[model samples]
Target: MAMPTIKAVRAYTVRGGGADYHDTQGYHWIDDHIATPMARYEEYRQSRRSFGINVLGTLVIEVEASDGTVGLGVTTAGEIGAFIVEKHLSRFLIGRQVTEIEKIWDQMYFATQFYGRKGVVVNTISGVDIALWDLLGKLRGEPVHALLGGPVRDELQFYATGARPDLAKEMGFIGGKLPLLHGPAEGDEGLKKNIEKLADMRSKVGDDFWLMYDCWMSLDLNYSIKLAQKAQEFGLKWIEECLSPDDYWGYADLKRNVPKGMLVTTGEHEATRWGFRMLLEMDCCDIIQPDVNWCGGITELIKISALADAHGKLMVPHGSGVYSYHFVITRHNSPFTEIIMSAPNADEVRPAFSPLLLDEPVPVNGRMKASALDKPGFGVRLNPEVKLHRPYAAA
Candidate 1:
């Protein structure tokens, strides 16, 4: 069989202004949003786990071939470096072997040296590269896991990273956690309310549940320490991002204040192996959470997992879990995986690998288990029936 050659790649964006923020997770604390699916890009809210998960602009990359197969990749629009995929990336991919997804990733990463390395630009490269991997795998007849190594476990173990007041014990999650709050957590009375709320959730769910709290770059170290000390009573699995990502000293302090068992997890916002290396080298974090979207996709995710393995550490991928499911399924050593308990991102649910034809089969228990699309490439789906909410011209 001849390798499918890329013929064309097009980018599209969607924005919906002042739409109801129906992310549900955001409404856990504040009941302000309107809950309307956006038709086009909205500027304020992009896809993020913490802070505000408002829908802003969605970026879609469609790669077409002469054989009629097309692969689709998505990231939030309006990101600083996403343009590389939208503008310059297609030139290199127009007539190359889609199966050479790994080589394509390296080329894209190094090709953008002139544009200053790291952050959004490199991340966008990874997003497109992952979609292409899914495309390439489908072109053949193997799963993406077969390409990486092989499946470590049939079903991935996950924790409900987002918690709700009502479904404390009803939800059959291995672990559960309270939502993170921002810095301006009011005065002492407000802090008291936050603590009481967490305490109530714990009381409702009882022990034997691994609880997590996301700081989401909200609270300062001092406040985080106070909460961490108080939070020890509830038996949390980890207190995430108590300090800033850069504040190694704060992490060290928070780690010291909390019980030995309470983990200090961060790096969800951090990017790449080098960025994760900092978290590893300092011994600042007991657990590392790198978002697959922001991180350099599977190529770097495997490398980062290896780093964690060498350090005798644990790696749990962060947001927009397209790449995360693949990583968690293939790697045996990775400890715990996560699912956005609120609502999985729409883009996350979108099929990125259409040309190959696949599905990101979700777990029967509301988590993503393993890829059934054990074809030759990344087992992802690209739906031709997609109606672009905001096309480039339409925007």
Candidate 2:
């Protein structure tokens, strides 16, 4: 059995809800008055869009094999991501063996190391790395999970990230994580409101159902401690990404100061093994939430997961559609997954990357069967009806 060689690599970008879930059009809850770091400024407080959260759009990467099978990867880098793929990263994969993913990933990372260690640069590499894995899965005629070792669990249980945890509770999720709506700038009154909101949701969902807050990197150390202390009364399961991902020391201190049973988690914005190394070694968090799309794809995720597992921490990934699904089902450290409710009201389940991917699976009653992911590759196709713009082309 011979493996296929990479034939061509193409990059494209699209707008309005795809891998870049933030690049949506409408009055969705994700873009609502959710608290963010930019909320300190009164002008940008109302909507995250005002701060350009959706400006990047969606980056789509396609790696075509010699046998004509094309593997796809999507992320939130948009046109800038396409430019990196077409002008810089493609050179690493153009003529290599499709199975030579490790070498290609190494080259892509180190080659762009000077200017690209994190942010959109790593995002582009992540897209490329994911595409390579998808290519390998298709070439091998197995799902990415099977390629990664095999499933350790029979199904994936999910915790919903949305505004309506009450609704999610009715939907059968293991838990619901709400976006914290007030930051330090809002003062004590805002802190009171934050507690009130949690109390309200707890009243609806009751005690046993897991409830958590996603601060979205919108709090300072003092404010985070205050919120966590208040949230403990409602039986909050965890406080997530409360401070900037760069604040490792702050995260460690927050972890130490948090209520006795509650967990302090972060790392969704951090990237690579090195970044996670800083988090784990410092004991900055109880769980590490890496978004597969943003955390250097499954290739780096494997390394990060191993590190976390060794450190006795959980690798609970952020909401990334099938890319996270395939990886989640296979790892022991990944006990459950996170799904971002896309509907405006979070009442109905929508594909995480809706309108961009066809045949994307949504959990039934907040649970997805492992059997549902039996298809080759990542088990979804690009929605051809969606427009993909190629911002740059390889010569």
Candidate 3:
């Protein structure tokens, strides 16, 4: 006889920070949703300047049946953690077995069908998928990355993200980029300052070190062209998000203008594999940064890398590199993944941050390495005692 499926799936959003966060009672008791009190650890995790900013406070889904067998999942939703579970996909996940992840994902897609696919719905699922993978890893005594296909690289090189020219060089990361920060002033003085940052960084860091600058979505064709011309003096390795997500023509034009060696990279907000394929077809980007959680999990990441390889582009997975580290380590010659070092208390979620999170925050001497872990799954272990704060409730 077939075993019974998960009969009831209830989710509790626990906060890890110290002290208690008052729940809006009016908001909490709607349907099967409930909130857990806050703890000190969680506040640090969710804090604007926490080291464990991105990876902590995952949504945990408990898959329990009347027979008592249980499965647990940890997922990423950035800051919108419980909202994803209690408000969005939690109800659809009832009655799923530990083995029914693919089916559950489909069910979630169907349930949230009215919201359309992408953005928050997809982000919520990304976290849920992470939780499922983690739960499975715990059940099997293996790390999530190991289950994905088995560990490959010995160490994952990390590039310090969110650095400007001086900070980038000072941190000893010769291989990273700074997000775009410019004002509306256009012309010679503005151009000079723009060019100077890159020039100064390259001068300080020396040659052979990779450097990138983020244009964000602010630059148009003229701005991109001007910046592209100025960037050559600094020998920038790549320019990220130089144009808007919708401006494929801008990329095409900027690509032609930015000389041959400087890479034009984008697509952190581009959704999934199909979105990436458009970039490939248009030859828009020399490097692709498909965020695995939002883009598509392990299954789709490999497919994306394969597509890039076939087309002579490299897949430099973006977003939370803590999780992306699994993908980076597995792919050969893939270098310089983004590391957004916030959440001051990083050790709360990723204990590896000590020796793992570099002083420079990139590979050693600007050549970081992905360390091998004896652990079974993603090599990340969570402190269950830590909880979530400010749980979202549907009123």
Candidate 4:
């Protein structure tokens, strides 16, 4: 028997909240006065959109096999990612065997090494690599988990990330991670309000609900330490991405300065095994949170997950819809996964990448059965009604 080869690779971009969850129109909790690196500047302090966080939009990649099976991937690189896929990365996929994921990934990475290693370039590669995995799974007639090695557990549990942990509690999540609303630029009053918010949520959800703060790379080391120390009274379970991804030394120091038993976590923006190696080797964090969409896709993620497991660290992937769900169920170290409640007020559960993906599964009461993902490939389809723009093409 012979195998099918990839025939054509296509790329498109979408606007307003798909994979680029920040590219939204009306008020979204994610874009609200959440503390971020740009918050230091008074002009961009009110909303993440002011700093053009949503400029990239969502990049959609599709790989069509010779057998007519097509695999899909979505990420935040938008039109720039589309250009990379069509103008540059498409050659690596077309005419290759569908099983050549690893080879193709290597080629894409090193070929774009000079201009691409992280950021949008790596994001493009990640999207293409993810499409390959989805294509392979469909061709093999198995769910992605079965292709990976079968699920270690019957279902996946989730923790919700949003502004309203109390509502998430009512929704049955194991834990609720709140976005930090204040930063160092706000001074002591900002820090005080930060603790006050946590204190209020604590009082609402009670102490045992497992509350944590997601600083979103907005804090300096000193301010993060101050916030963590104050949050200890509310039994803060973790403090995430408080500093820039490049600050390994600061992360290590923050890890040491945090209250005993309070976990320090980062890496939603970090890419590749080499970048993660720095985090693990430096003892920079207690757990690593990689977004499969942004962290080199399933191909590199498998390697990154192994590295964390070997170092005795948990790899709780960032909230990335079904992408995180498929991989988390197959690993022991991934005891639970994340869901960034996309509901306007975080008052209800909604598919993380809503409207862009059809048949995309959302957790029922904070748990998703392995069977929900039993369909071939990633078990979801790109919503045809959602307009797709092809900005570049290969001749």
Alpha-carbon error at 301 in model 3, in Å? Answer: 2.8
Clashing pairs in 4: none
lDDT, candidate 4, 264-294, per-residue tens: 9999999999999999999999999998999
Instruction: Count clashes in each candidate, considering only residues at least 3 apart in sequence or on different chains.
Output: 24, 0, 41, 0
**Model 1 TM-score relative to the real fold:** 0.80
On the 0 to 100 scale, the lDDT of residue 183 in model 1 is 35
In candidate 1, what are the lDDT values of residues 1-395, reduced to their tens digit?
A: 78878877766543321111222343333222111122012332233323345344445566776686766565543333345665667667878887766777777777876873565676577667666766766666666777777777876766655546335335455776566542333546656766787787788877776777876666677777777777788786788866667777777676677776788888876777887887788787888888666677777787888998888888877745445666677776675577554333221222222222235554444345565535455545544454444333211
Off by over 4 Å in 2: none
For residue 229, give model 3's deviation from the true position in Å: 1.2
The superposed Cα distance between candidate 2 and the true structure at residue 344, in angstroms, equals 1.1
Off by over 4 Å in 1: 15-56, 78-82, 113-118, 165-168, 182-185, 343-359, 366-386, 389-395
The global C-alpha lDDT for each of the candidates, from Candidate 1 onward, is 0.61, 0.93, 0.56, 0.92
Residue 185, candidate 4: alpha-carbon lDDT: 95
What would you estimate as the lDDT of candidate 2? Answer: 0.93
Once model 1 is optimally superposed onto the true structure by TM-score, how far is the C-alpha of residue 345 displaced, in angstroms? 15
* Model 1: residue 228 alpha-carbon error in angstroms: 1.0
Shift in Å, residue 5, candidate 2: 0.8
Estimate the TM-score of every prediction: 0.80, 0.99, 0.72, 0.99
Better of 2 and 3 by TM-score: 2
Residue 212, candidate 1: Cα error in Å is 0.9
